[model samples]
Target: MYQTDNLKQKIKLFMIIFFPILITQVSLNLMTFFDTVMSGRAGAEDLAGVAIGSSLWVPVFTGINGILLAITPIIAQLLGAQEDKSIKQKVQQAMYLSVGLAIAILLLGLILLNPILNTMDLEYEVRHIAKFYLITLGVGIIPLFIFNTLRCFMDALGQTRMSMIIILIALPINLLFNYIFIFGKFGVPAFGGIGAGIATALTYWVISLLAIAILYKVAPFRDYQLFSSWVRPRVKEWLEQLKIGVPIGFAIFFETSIFAAVTLLMSAYSTNTIAAHQAAMNFSSLLYMIPLSVGMALTITVGFEVGAKRMQDAKVYGYIGISGGIFIALFNGIVLFAFNDYVAGLYNTDPDVIALTVQFIGFAIVYQLADAFGAPIQGALRGYKDVNMTLVIALVSYWVIGLPTGWILANYTSLEPFGYWVGIITGLSCGALALLARLIHIQKKYRNQIENSSAT
Candidate 1:
């Protein structure tokens, strides 16, 4: 009874943190959805332009964010150790890093823009519009990174509601801007999809500035004095963040790129196939937010406990997070599976797209549990600062094993798109199992270290 009660309490705590983060994530995604929808109304060419631009930007942006994600656990650990004095310095260095990296990314994007577009063989109009969109959006990258840096800092300290509220405020603002700019409302020139990019860029600046103000002026955060003084960037601290962050960045890149690759590969099939795949992927991605949020909360909790030198408690929290994630996954899987047709219909009215989407959803259902397991385990690893192995596992599981199997099944066999999804299932399962094993091994290793220290 005690164990059960403890698990319930832990789960409750996890949810308390998870839901707000989940809402923030959903709001961010909704911003993108609004951009896409509004751009689509402009024209097919405009839509394709935004889509192509997004494909280029999303991976790079996601990679940068992943790298910065290291700060979350680092901050959590600092707070856990009650080393509040050190927090400002670390955040300052992170701010410097974020700005520097953002500028570099922008320059790189500019340098690579023409070359990358040339290789895509896109229609001239599409290519031209995409170039404009990229350039416009590129201007916002710095603010985006800055916002993310402060957001991570706050979330690590368990101040999620503020960030969530800020993001919520931005969503409607983003839509209003998108409408005005995309349609040239109130005398604004119709920049079409490029206008959407402009609106998003402007939104980034707004949100980042708001976040900065909140961190500096908000009552809960005022005592931290996060911006009290700028610290010169130290090589050792930057290296430390890179050591933990680069692998995480690559891990995220690998996962997102694989899905992108699959979508590109599916282009070889019928338009209906592509549409169906996208519909299924969209819904599945939304469902994924649940576990992702829980996983992030677990990272903070476990990192805090570990920093406090409470390894057993960390382990307990890790298990509770994993268990909670699995339960959520089970529930999502059943709902998605049972309502596949009905849900797919929500995205499209075409009978063919609907049928194909339902079929794809079936595969998503099978792997939902694996996804749930893998994501939280990864989070737990991050909390323990055990991140390098995750990159290796992801590489082997997704590329070496999963992608090849998928390619062969997709190309050599009649399974086609279904085969690719099967590969996803295999990869996710392998990743989940591998991550679980690593978590167990690390827990035992930490326990032994503590035991030895005590005995000595």
Candidate 2:
């Protein structure tokens, strides 16, 4: 019932789109690493403070990203089906919902940061630094919805390279702000950890604004006018998006919680160990961008196919995405594993910290490959609008297996920090295996049904 194209072109398209995204993400991640490294040099407490606060902030920000993702695939499908009439209306509705959700998350972050730091039971300096970091981070996050709304529309129209360009502008600005604000270089006051917070807050606003300008200037969004109609969201459409988005949000939270919990636990180790762990994690974050960007590309392609009711085409796109991820992951893994010592040293200079970071980096490389396989599968599921089942797998993987496994191994066994990383491995393996099986099963069933109908 559905027409399909060759996998080679699909792979090519995925890569072509992914390259820019990968570069943007890697650049942005390096900016973050630079910020953390700057603070780490000021003092371990300064570094620890930013690390603790960032863990809390990122999940909240990511939750909004997850919610916005719900609208993107639907927009993709709508594009493929040539449903131009409803496109503006659907995007407007999703934007309205996203703004509300982003505000809510930002507010929650603002209100909870103090309560959270109060409970961290750290030294007063650490707690003070974390609290300041969170408050400023929250201040600038309010405009995040604006960025996502434009980006989502661009994504639906197959214009993701613009995201790279926008971030390219923001990356240098962030580094500049961090340099001036953190160490007070160039005659600025040394804000230290507080300066990192200030720089981060400013970076978000710059990226959000810069991204919009880039979208309007360069992209082919002449069809979808972002300012044309500021109508109230249709109640019916809002309900539909929420029904699709909320479960995915929960799944994002489930995964974020495991990583956050582990990062917090690592604080129980020596300050240097925590620093080492953060460096490795920061680098891993960069590696993660490859799979994430690939997954996103596949989602767009697959969603386009699915909306056209070309199920086979969708499956092929998924295959292309996963293959792309495997190749990228293997290449990056080999490089990271080979240069674990150098890679860890890039974040901090202490010998013990570097050694610990090397250990974590080795584990992260292996886990990233597993994560690479899983990330695209999640994106594919999103493409098919298959959030509910994926949510179950995420819940079981992170909450059921990941959290408890890490705690038991890290606290009770001799593995300690390495034990905690095994949890990341378990979660990735479960997510990848479970989602892969589900994707195949669904494709097989749908294909059979189509065949049966044709026979009739």
Candidate 3:
């Protein structure tokens, strides 16, 4: 009875943490959904422009977010070990890293913006709009990174509800701004697709400022004293973080870049293809929030267990998380497969766009099933600080195997978008299987260590 009750308590705790994080993720993905839908209404060309611009920028944003993700487990473990004083310094270091990375991304975006667009073989108008969108969005990358850093910090402390509230508030604001700018409402001239970029930039700034204010004024966060003193960048700390974060960043880049590559390749086909791809991708992202949320929660949970020197508990939590994620993926996959046409219609009314979107959705369902296992297992590894291998696996699966196969199938066969999606499935499946195997190995090793210590 005690054991059953304990298991129930753990499940309840996981739900409490998981739901808010899931909602927060959903809100973030909704921003992209809004952008795509609004742009689609403008025209096919506008939709394609947003799609291309999103492909270019999402990788940059996600890569930086992945790098900053190092902060979460660091803080989680610190909190778990009751090492409260150490958190302030680490938080400060993360802030410095965030600002530096934001600036670097901004500069890189400026340098490569035009040249990258020119090489894409896009239509003149599409290219022009895409360039405008990319530049406008680029202006906000700094604040976006800062916001992400704050979010990660709070998440580590198990304060996801506040973060979810802030993001939920931002959603309506994003929509209002997108409406006013994209359609030129309330006396503003229509910026069309580029207007979505402007809205996104403004939203990032608002969210960043709000997050900072919350960290400063919130009663719970006051305990961390994150803002008590400003510290100069420490070479040792920064290098240590980078040592952990760079592999994470590269792992994210590998997965995201494959999709970006697919988007670029699809650009050569037709505007309809791009628009269809955008719809399918956006919906897939929305569904992805499920496993991703669970995975994120697993990171904090497992990190806490590890910090408490409860290796067996950490392993148990990892198993629960991975299993829950796969189950959710199966449920979502069924829904998507059954209702794909309805979902596609929600994005665009054009028959051609809808038809292509349905086909792409089929691929997305398979990809999600693989991703269900991949994402959470990766998160479990992060908690164990077992990341470098995951990076190597991602590189080999996505770039070495996935992309080349996709290229050949997409270019040489009649598969077109289907071929690219097949590649996504292959890569995600490979990643999932590899990570799961690693997790089993690590669990065995840790169990042996525990047994030896007990014997001693």
**lDDT per model vs. reference:** 0.83, 0.79, 0.87
Off by over 4 Å in 3: 1-5, 454-456
List ranges where model 2 is wrong by over 4 Å.
1-4, 215-219, 449-456
Weakest ten-residue segment in model 3 by summed lDDT: 1-10
**Model 3 over residues 333-441: C-alpha lDDT tens digits?**
9999999999999878999889999999988988999888788998888887778998999999999888888888887899976798888888888888988998898
How many residue pairs clash per model? 0, 0, 0
Evaluate model 3: give its TM-score: 0.97
Q: Candidate 2's residue-wise lDDT over 1-100, tens digit each?
A: 1233676666667666668767876776776687788888888788888888877776666666777777878888888898868787787787778777
Error of 3 at 245 (Å): 0.9
User: In model 1, which runs have C-alpha deviations exceeding 4 angstroms?
Assistant: 1-9, 41-48, 121-130, 270-275, 338-356
TM-score of each model, in listed order: 0.92, 0.94, 0.97
Task: Please state the error at residue 398 of candidate 2 in Å.
Answer: 1.4
Q: For model 3, what is the error of residue 392's alpha carbon versus the real structure, in angstroms, after optimal superposition? A: 0.5
lDDT of 1 by residue, 1-456 (tens): 012126567666667777889999878877666676577567656766666676677778877888899999999998888888888899889988899899999889879989988877566877777899989988789999999999989889888888899998998899989999999999999999899899899999989999989988987787888887777889898888989999988887777666766765665666567657766776677788778888888888889888888888889989888887889899989989889999777655668778998999999898777888888888889999998899999888888878888899998898988999999888888988998999999999999998999999
Ranking by lDDT: 3, 1, 2
